[model samples]
Target: MTGAPSPGLGCVGAPRLLAGLDRMPRLDRTAHLGVHGQLPQLGPDELIALAEDIELRGRGGAGFPFARKLRAVSRSARARDGSTAVVVNGSEGEPSCLKDTALLLHAPHLVLDGALLSAAALGAEDVVVAVTRTDVEQSVREAVAERGPAGRRVRVVRLPERFVTGEGTALVSGLNGGAALPSGQKVRTSERGLNGVPTLLSNTETFAQLAVAARLGAAQYRTAGLASEPGTVLLTVAGSTVVETPTGTSLAYVLDLCGTEPGQGVLVGGFHGRWLDPASARASEVSRKSLAAFDAVLGAGAVLPLPQDTCPAGEVARVTRWMAKESAGQCGPCVRGLPALADVLEDAVRGGGAAALDAVRTRMAVVRGRGACSHPDGTSSFVASALAAFPEEFRDHALGSGCGRRVLGALPLPEDENPERLVVDWTLCKGHGLCVDILPDVVRLDADGYPAEASMPVPGRLRPKALRAVRRCPALALRIRE
Candidate 1:
């Protein structure tokens, strides 16, 4: 588990999911069985009882209770054809988070045991494990092969790695042979998922936790964590180390243990998570309740401690721009509002003064609760929290000045894919001005009604509008280039 996914792969008290990493880095079938013992097969009711007794919750962003999901899918199955499917959302698409990858890469059997046990109890014949990386896929495949006949019903699928690709609806859609994009409408995975059947979908660590809970039973599982919240949580600390820290552990201790400190502040979650001031970060604990007390979320278990040297406003701008490009391009808020927000933030950081800073605040309010998914709201939160947490720095920048420190490029962003931009077919031009009405910001008519900038590096936010312009062009002169 310490193989790059986490450099300092240690634990607080005792590691649960990351139990035997020191002795056997990669727990093959023999070592896995020896360390964790056999997978216990529990009935549906018994499984739900164990989850409820242990107060088990998903390790994913929302932290929904696993028992409630299991019960919902169970009822749906009985109401329908007794058909249910189990999905392991191992898609660690976020660039900073790596606990799921550590678990899948090192302890694949533990995850499989949790998934296979659930599938058997649910009476579901189909089980699909969705991943993003190829090597991680190979590790899972090897684990399945080690299981032999027991792993027949389990199928592994690799999806495109993106910020929102790991969402429940997107993963479900991808499993059904469709694009890995979230549905515009709300999708109840427990009701109809993976080919129109009741499905029990959960995060990678959630399932792994379930497997550990089953082996130890609820009583033993309760012994590991506090009375308020039981069991250890997997935290991707400082974007480099993955620690199996128990709930209610001090956040400051984790950072110090991982050889980092809260400089400017701490980003408790990944990109979508909130920023806490040094005091809040120091006082905070690892549990959901503890983080929630400070209006922060223990989301995805990514505890990123920002360094003091880098400019806070510039770092926020860099992340905002990257998130704008990661938009699903589904709604107006995403296709328009996010890029607008990014532009305003960049402007504010580069001495745009009060006007740009006010624009940033206005856009934050406008984009909240206005997207098909939580993507827009998440981006808005990241900006809003930065503004709140580091007001003095932002105020200085707003007064036509900067922090003088360079943007150290501390945050993570993936390599850019082949993004599309508008292209004009000069041969098929008819000088129609229809394109101008559709894309006012992009298509400026020259002396002749033609695009002035022939090859514009179109931002991801305007791709949808550009398409609209291309379709509406009366001359059929508009085209797209990769």
Candidate 2:
């Protein structure tokens, strides 16, 4: 299933997950064999020890200790008297992210090597790689086919392409034929996942690094990056180009790689990530530990640079609106509070007074940690960081007119195939109070007694009510669409 790997534009330093990607050859079975040779067969205890020795943490956003996750699943399997399962998550759900897909597309064999190696170590019979895009699926599938019987053991599940569908538990749910949404309750995927069996689920980059660490051993693996966070990390630079740079690489250097200088600020960790001013961003490094000082994490390897020419307040407003639309609509706070936050930001951008800023603060407080998932919390962090990071620009928008710069769209929000955005056909509308009355949480009326806007792409919780309102609309003005 492997195509020719893309020749990367060479690493600023050492490359691991993106090793030799500059050659631009997909590490197919033969090429993979030529480069890394055969995967070393390691017993479960040995692999876990090696991970511990190298302090290999999950490359996923949380940066959970890899050794701990392996031990948890292994111990759980032993207790249940049944084998565990492994899931290599490649569902790059965030619009500003593509590192997982890039890793698989260029080096599918490496991901497979890690997954297979992990399966043997964990005594798991089933291994699944969940991906959202078709290209990634094809690349990994071809690589699997090349492995023949060895590849047959690895299953590639194409998941729904939604922002939250890539959540660990949600990926597990989808793999088991359930809807691709995070569970309403807080449950670890390692404890009860994949048909109620303990599952070892890690990001694609984590597994790829697992293979690299197993091959290099602990001492060699620690050769690059800081002692605390060793090895290279694959990053999707600016939502477009992909690079594998050493951990702790300067954000300035990352901007250089992306061919853009630091502007007003830079967004680390994608839409759900935080914003840092130019100076703080340049001082910060790519590692999770380093980013923690800025109250940020290296979430999903997304690093976007915000241009100064663009109106920062307007850009933040647009992204906040998008994040609000992406909500699963599973929780009350996330469903209602996000749009409120976006509205305040937009109002500030449009020259609303200090009241808008107060509303933003209040709504941000209301949405924190009150969701079934982290959407509310993450979205809150995003908006709050925008305010804190660019106080001057935000204040200008709030107090005076805007910054006079148009929104340059420095932040990219890729279009979704199934948008599910809420819309109103104003041409067909007579004054309709049904929508406003039925879905009070979302729909509101304008001065002319017409439905204004319900924050298009109504949250999932209100969609049913929205649909009911749409159906009952005498003028048929309201509709939900992609």
Best by lDDT: 1
lDDT of 2 by residue, 1-482 (tens): 12223323336676677766667557788877777777898998899998898888787787899889998998888889777989998887776777787788888989888889989988888999998877888889999899898778889889878788888767888999988888878787778888789999998988888898888888999989888888888777766778878787887888887788778888888888888778888899878878889887887778888876887887788788888887887888778889888877777766678888988999999999788898888889888888899888888888976677766567777544354665788788788588777767666778988767744655433343466677889988778775
TM-score of model 2 relative to the true fold?
A: 0.85
TM-scores of the models, in the order given: 0.86, 0.85
Top candidate (TM-score): 1
Clashes of each: 0, 16
Q: Write the per-residue lDDT of candidate 1 for residues 300-406, one digit (tens) a residue.
A: 99988889898888788878988987898889999999999998887787677899899999999999998999999999999999899999889888786678776
Worst 10 residues of 1 by lDDT: 1-10
Q: Rate the local accuracy (lDDT) of all candidates.
A: 0.86, 0.80
The local lDDT score (0 to 100) that residue 34 gets in candidate 2 is 74
